[model samples]
Target: MDPGCHKLYHVHGFDSRQFLEHYLSDKADMVFGEESLKFPIENLTKVFTEGHIKGDVLIDLSLSSMVHHLYSACEFFNHIIVLKAQDRCILELKRWLNTRTGAFDWGHATKLHADIEGKCDQLQDKEEKVRSAVQHVMRCNLEQENMTDPIVLPPADCIISTWILGAISKDQDEYIRYLRKFSGLLKPGGHLIIIEDLDGTYYTVGNERHHYLTCDEDFLRKALVGEGFVINYCKVQKRTNMSDLVDYSSSIFIAAHREKSV
Candidate 1:
């Protein structure tokens, strides 16, 4: 297939609801649950539990319209601001936040989170905490000087972006460009956490095929150092699920902090 024919996720847009059901749902036999649900939740829980990443404001730029990743952060952060490139993603999140009808069931994710922390009985409370911490969700454009232009966000203490760089960036240069924008949003010495599927070329959601920037651990390490971020933690889990919809060898989790001088 010609790269030119690929449907660019940043340009062609995405189906947020379908994306959730396909990748994050428990009932779906897609095998993405291990990577998309459990892997991130468990690793994020560990990173937060270690007490290394601490802050008041947390900005989330994760892939799709998911809140499972924030299950751990809400326990640590005072506020969470979700930034999305698509309005549908915002609407999907709003549906769940407002407790409206047709919201995607996140019970499985909540259960996974609670079980990992050995607080299975507090599942409902865990869900509510995430809702409470997420005070705002706004549209973002990575190309703009201010992603949330006209509304300059205060320098964040920590920012977490998962898989979005892969979905939006067409190449390494573009990925670094987005990374610079992400760094700009953070204050000096601020933390940045990223979870990405390494070496993936593309992924399918519903009937659309979205391009993924092919990258590996070495490239990411060099990129972060070049951007003046000191890597705090990095982990890679080999892909265990065999799926035809996406081609990724492994998933990478990185925790880093931007230098004050750079």
Candidate 2:
């Protein structure tokens, strides 16, 4: 199985951000019986806007598909490190960073973000802000003891991995192990943001079908607590048939700080 084949929910290359906007962030279909429920990206914007933590040295443990959610984070962080297991993913991200002729379309995502933050007129400006914040795109292996070995790096103020552990982890045991390893990359009291696919065993990016480690909030919460994390905020977005193409049922987004109890 090609390990890098896993995608951001159902996105392979950039297209419409509709999957993100309507299904993930929209209230009509996304909210069940909660108090104005929002998706991970939307919640993340609120988190950043609340002025909680400025992840100055943010480490993106896995570069999933798009950096739409990290746009707000760029406004707070000085440096961003994006890591992917495959060379193609790294190169594709580099192509976008360097502004190559055919970079994947991220305009749709930026427009959505602008609407969320009420900054509609500054879409282009926000895009550049994200571009400038991302400083490194490195290759990494999630299986290794130290994912980014031989490349000495500073302890991250925050680490963000969206829908990656499920795609790469062999099973629940390995998922817990990976969580422990990721925690070491952060400083004490640092933040860890993880967005996962709930109750998803498979997702199709094209004609090919890729498998993921199916998990839910209970399992994930246990894993995080096992790794010495305190949950701050968690949002679960129930999937609507809006993106009926993808097999995922719900998207889980968690933001926890690593301020372990004594």
Candidate 3:
């Protein structure tokens, strides 16, 4: 489900915060943070230095709003182009970016990221960093071969996609096709970071249910390699808690670099 597209806040006592507190990080103490958040941030910090940070990075920032993938990213990329699948998603992101009246509460996310970096108290600073780093917010169609279509954005130094692919693709073949289109937006040798659900078919947001494409590591590995990526890092976080609403066995984080053309 596109979080920005959902009517989450209106639902009274929405326990999404509590659910995330459990799912995204370890249930006990939450010391390490969630694998989905921790993996990509740590990897980005390690690979791309401040010198390479001035280039373009394209991302689906709507998902990152709650997940806070941009927490580490903003530390590097000077130009961030956020690709929104719908105008609603664009509006949702803008609300937070503009610091509007009722933007999605990211306090939990902001603090978590700071703690991960050992800067435990500067929540507002972290939020401002992300807000300032994102320079462009534009529309994209995941089903189309040309994701950005007429925009023709500068080829990105990196690209990050969250759970949107599973919602858009009906099956494995479509997943690969979508992946190829996303990867093509990156310059050769540019990095691609994906956070995917493993064996996940459905999840619930508020009271509504959403469908997802179930995929395994083998499928992901083949897709990346066939699409010309050499895997740099990969890992799976087995589901520790179960809820009737979401049916996912694990979360997998993959970081791969596109092979340079001769």
Candidate 4:
């Protein structure tokens, strides 16, 4: 398996199917149900089912929950493709998988596992920090993009991104440019799945602030349509969190190809 791909599995905690199931359910609740917003759970279920039947690639971008589901239900696809910004997320995932022997001392391994489990206990705890880490790394990647044309990693048949495009760049124009580059990474006719926090709000990690754009459903739908992606299904859900520091209103988008070109 590719090291990067393996790392994503490990960081997302795919040690067992039961764990993945619980994680997805909790994520669905936090982002959709709790905030009184609707999510495309059924659409996601359909995509997974189709991918399973056709043995196609599921390209997951930043959406750890869907990736977790796909990895747990291994029989659904030929292989998984994960696009992640942080090396630490990958490393943590690999540690969770325990793929390398002698990589960690027994005591250290025990502690690491406990830490991962504790973080996974709630969606907000895991998501806030993980996304912050991804954002920091993505900022680096965006800066690198200025020096050279963006590099397209291996392609996939179905692409899923959550909280990804809205966080592209601090500047709106730069964000659009970055997203266009991201769109170019997908193969023609491939699927695109997105979930984002709609309202402009802040999520804190140990007292640090991570700013977000006000990505309402209309703005995103219009943006994707303008980008030439057909709307297969779109749902705006309220994402609620128990924490006072975190924003509770968010939206989820699940879109597919409208034509054969990017």
Writing each residue's lDDT as its tens digit, candidate 4 over 160-250 gives: 6666555444545655665666676566766666767776554433333444455567767777777788877666655545555446365
Q: How would the candidate models be sorted by TM-score, starting from the highest? A: 1, 2, 3, 4
Q: Residues 1-262, candidate 3: write the lDDT tens digits.
A: 3333432221211344443443454455543354555655664555544344335565543342343777788877777888866555567668889999976666766776676677887788889988888888887766567767777778888887777677566678878877888877888788888878888776665465556777898999999999888888787778764467667788777878888642
Judged by whole-model lDDT over C-alpha atoms, candidate 2 comes out at: 0.71
Score every model by TM-score.
0.97, 0.83, 0.80, 0.61
Could you give candidate 1's per-residue lDDT for residues 67-160 as a string of tens digits? 9999999988999999998888999999999899999989999999999999999999999999999999999987789889899898898999
Worst 10 residues of 1 by lDDT: 1-10
Model 3: per-residue Cα lDDT at residue 250: 80
Which of 1 and 2 is ahead in TM-score?
Answer: 1
- Candidate 2, residues 1-262, lDDT tens digits: the string is 3335554322343222332332233354543212112365587797778887686799886534457768888988999989777666676667778888876666756777788889999998998998899998887766677677888778999888876788667578978877888788888999999988787766544344555777889999999987889999888877755443446677788889987732
Error of 4 at 66 (Å): 8.3
Backbone Cα, N, C clashes tallied per candidate: 0, 0, 1, 5
lDDT of 4 at 100: 61
- For candidate 3, the C-alpha RMSD (Å) to the true structure equals 5.7
Residue 79 error for model 1, in Å? Answer: 0.8
Looking at model 3, residue 113 earns an lDDT score of 67
227 Cα displacement, candidate 1 (Å): 0.8
By TM-score, the best candidate is 1
